[model samples]
Target: MKDTGLVAMTEFLRHPSMVGSAFPATARMVRHMLAPIDWDNVRTAVEYGPGSGRFTFAMLARMRPDARLLAIETGAEFVEKLRASSDDPRLIVAHGSAEDVGRHLTENSLGYADVILSGLPFSTLKQEDAETIMRVTGSALAPSGIFAAYQMRTAVLSLINRQFVDVRQGYEWWNIPPCHLYWASKLRGEGSYEDQIGGSASA
Candidate 1:
């Protein structure tokens, strides 16, 4: 079996749009991105663009036995790799776009996730697509749930701020090329998904 790093690099070279990053996140980066999560209370977690399952493995190690994880990936190869990497019944690897995270959650019979972690390169994505993902992520999170991601650029910071009520930033220089980690939390009174969509449509 190829190592996770090789697999991730190959996938990125094959599909930059889907893979997002040329290198898998280092252990340090993963730690920083997951630092704010209270695993004991995190019943549901959704990971977007889980390239090589680096963070996924870490999350599973700390999550409660009853907790469930939905790993959503656009790359077929990555999805297959993820499925093969873990046999934990608590994990559900979905092959799809992150923009439709709400549908993925509903299909899995899951309510809003307690935490949403993303490895998708929002800076590399189109502005509209990035905004759509941020909106869907905000609406799909449970009240006060966290949405965390490590990005290579600051372009998506504004989008996150627009959708989430509170936003915090951190840096990890140990990773290759380094990155900025964004920790954003949904507001407690954001209302239901329908309400959010209706408000957006009206605006």
Candidate 2:
């Protein structure tokens, strides 16, 4: 996570499921996961569980200057690192769960995110916690916006499908365990979102 090389043993020990070749992700996986975003049109972007900011910094590089980035991280170390690592004004690092993405957006004066990327280890997350994060993601994404995530397991695919209509997948074999990637686009009014996700659109 520190570089494009193997992640630190300490991090892998704490985040047991984040290991894939003892490396969180390479630049290859990062590029593949973030390929669908519309950089020109994006006004707000978000990232979930950005351990050492692999994809987070990449998004900052390509996004429009006026765009804002809200990074929701649960790890206190990562939260501090991301905040101290950037003075880009556009970046806002929040030390909290992805379930509160709505509040993060509102507090930052951001509408629905034009795109969101996640590196959370869903394979290790509690069922209720994972469900809450995905449901919140659906409500936080703009119509036609992208929600992308990379995982080492297939379990997250079904969860992501329930929220987005158009789903696409990729595989990054550059790592040992092989990362499974998914990016989905939310529909205009994603199927009675109030009933399914229990939130009104902020955009």
- Pick the TM-score winner: 1
Q: Model 2: per-residue lDDT, tens digit, 91-173?
A: 99998888999999999899898888887878888899889999999999887788888888888998998988877667777
Report the error of model 2 at residue 84, Å: 1.9
Q: What's the TM-score of each model vs. the native?
A: 0.89, 0.84
Clashing pairs in 2: none
- Candidate maximizing lDDT: 1
Give lDDT per model, in order. Answer: 0.82, 0.75
Evaluated against the true structure, the overall lDDT of model 2 is: 0.75
**What's each prediction's clash count?**
0, 0
- Model 1: per-residue lDDT, tens digit, 90-125? 999999999999999999998999999988888888
